[model samples]
Target: MLKNKKLAVIGVGKLGEALISGLLKRNAVEASDVTGSVAHEPSISRVKERLNINVTLDNCEAIKGKDVILLAVKPQNMDRVLKEISSSVKPDQLVISVAASVTTSFVEERLPDGIPVVRAMPNTPSVINAGMAGLCAGANASEDHKSMAEAIFKCVGETVFVDESLMDGVTALSASGPAYLYVVIESLAEAGVKLGISRETSTLLAAQTMLGSAKMILDSKQHPAMLKDMVTTPAGCTIDGLMELEEGKLRVTLIKAVVKAAERARELVNTQTSKFSK
Candidate 1:
């Protein structure tokens, strides 16, 4: 969808760098078609040198004449960045924001009315093209805008479209899910170490198991429960492990954590809206 498009990424941090790299790696956009806006001299210099793309400290200059503008800045810095570029953003340009708490309305309020906006929650996994991204469009956004958003995200990872209301849940699940997985990996690794496995080997086993399990879910087309049941023979070792997890209320804990995180994401959005209102 971004073929031959002039795109500007208005944050050159790790996520921004990842998106840029993904786009180029996937041939989504050519080097000359991409530009980066960053405040840190080192990041700007490094991205420019590595990608051979345009990089500037000025957000407005970076976005000028761009067909797509990616708002990759931190939530707190969004207002300042928008203020810096609002005057230059063309009315027809599509704005895609990956900011955690910044909603579509939050972004639209900063730009001219009628401009298309898409709010996406893409995880750290996007850095590796294995990420899952949840996307939503503003009231003014057209189908074409949605398609563009999907195309861009699909290049880096899987993309799912949902109502803007569910974005908070998406944020809690996929965007914050990596940290949860990391904790799980660490815990499992520690358990392995306690069971006499070397720390290095335990870490590798934990990571590979995660990778393999994810692949199975994607490839099998079988329900996850079905897959689990297939491994769980009657009175088997797998069943014993499952019993231990059940005793710890693992599923309940995860469900509660997801619910709490979603609520917190909603609170963050409300807070941003409140602060902007004031």
Candidate 2:
């Protein structure tokens, strides 16, 4: 979908590099067709050397006349970056933001109206092209614009369209979900060490099990509950472990953690809107 498109990434951080790498590996856009901007001189040089793409420290120069502008900067610096590029962004250009808690409305307010914009929340797994991104389009975005955003994200992993209002929940779920998974993995590794396994072996065992389990769920086409039942034979060791988990209220606690994280995401959104308004 991005064939021959003039694309510019406004950051060369970890997430930005992953996105650019994914785009190149997928042949979504040629290296010559992509440009990047960074705050420092060394980062600018580093992206150019690493990705063989155009790099600049000037945010406006990177965005100028680009068909698609990706705002990959941090939320704290979003206002400064947007304002810097606002005058140069044309009505025909499409702006895709990967910054969390910064809404399309907030972007539009800072830029010229009628410039298409899409807000996306993508997590750290995107660094490995195994990410899930939740997308929300702005009022001025056209179907073609939305499709381009979808295609770009799909190159890295899965993309889901949701109402802008629900983007915070999406952020809380899939965007923040990787950290939750990491916590689980860490705890399991510690448990393994306690059970007499070497630390390195326990880490590898826990990670591989999690990876295999996720793949099984994806490839099996069976409900997770059914899959669980398949492992829990009548009066088996698996069932004994399951009973222990239930007794400890593990499922309930995990559900509550997700809820709390989603609430925190919503709070951040509210705070961002309020701060921008002020």
Candidate 3:
């Protein structure tokens, strides 16, 4: 769907670079069809060398005549970048923002009327094409715009559409989830090490187990509890581990973690909006 489209990524940071790489690798968009902008002259060379695409420090110049403009700058930088490119962004073009905590309404407020805006929250795993993304459209975004936005993310990983109101939850869950899962893997690896396993082997065991378990959940489409039962016998060692986890309140702790992160995401969104409002 994005084959012939000219896309300008306003910030060629890690996430932006990952999306560009995925698009090119997936043949969704050619290297020549994409342009990227960075904040510094040094970064211009780095992005150009890394992605082999045109890179510039001028956001307006990068976005001019682009069919899809992706705002991948930091949330705090969103307002300034939007203003810089506002005049160049035509109504016929699509604007997609991957800036965390920056709402579609906030993006629309800065651009001309009827410029379609799609807000996406993609996780770090997108760098490896195993990411999950949640997307929502602004008032002016049409179904076609939504599909194009989905196509961009799908190049990197999976995509799901959610009501805009649920975007903060998505941010707290999938976008921030990798860090939490990394902690779990690290802890499990530490446990293996404590049990006399070598560190490297322990990490491999922990990470691969987690990967396999996740795949089971996805492929079987069964309740995770059922799958857990499949591994956990009545008097097995797995049940003992489960008991310890329950005693440690692991489940509730994870639940609270996601809830707290969502709350913080909402606060950050309000802060970004208020900062830009001024």
Candidate 4:
């Protein structure tokens, strides 16, 4: 779907670089078809050396004539970047923003009228082509624009459409999820070390187990509770381990963690809106 399209990524930071790398590595878009803008001259050289693409410090110059413009700037910097390029962004171009806590309305309000905007929240795993993204379209966005946004993210990993109101939940559950899972993995690895396992082997075991479990959830299409039941045989060791987790209130703790994170996400959105309000 993205073939023959020129993409300009604003703020070629880590996530921007990851998307560009994924696009090139997957043959979704050729390196020559992509241009990236960074804030400073030092970053221009960094992007050029790392991605071998055309790099510029001028946001307006970088986005000129581009078919799709990915706004990968930090949320705190979104207003400044949008104001910088708003004049250059044409109505025909698709604008996709990956800024956390920044909404489609927030972006659309900054750009020219009828400029389609898509808000996407993608995690760090996108760097490895195993990410998950939650997408939503602004009022002016058309079906084709939505598809283009999906195609861009699908190059890196999975994409799911959700209502704009639920974006904060998605941000907390998936975008911030990797960090929480990493903590779980670390704790599991420490348990292995306590059980006399080598640190390297323990980490591999913990990480691989988490990966396989997640795959099973996705591939089997069975309720996670059902899968847990399948693993818990009568009076088995797995049941004993599950009991320990229950005693520790692990489920409730995780639920509260996500809830708190979502609350924080909403707060940040309001903060950004206030900071950028006209």
**Alpha carbon lDDT of each predicted model:** 0.91, 0.89, 0.94, 0.94
Scored by Cα lDDT, where does model 4 land?
0.94
lDDT tens per residue, model 3, 27-121 = 89889989999999899879988899999898998988899999999998999988888888899899999999999989998998889999999
Model 1 agreement with the true structure over 33-97: per-residue lDDT tens digits = 99898887787779888788999988888888899999998888898888778878888899999
Q: If scored against the real structure, what TM-score would every candidate get?
A: 0.96, 0.95, 0.98, 0.98
Cα lDDT for residue 25, candidate 3: 92
List ranges where model 4 is wrong by over 4 Å.
Answer: none
Clashes of 3: 0
Over 4 Å off in model 1, which ranges? Answer: none
Clashing pairs in 2: none
| Residue-level lDDT tens digits of model 2 in 173-220 | 898788888888998999999999998999999999999888899899
- List runs of model 2 lying over 4 Å from the truth: none
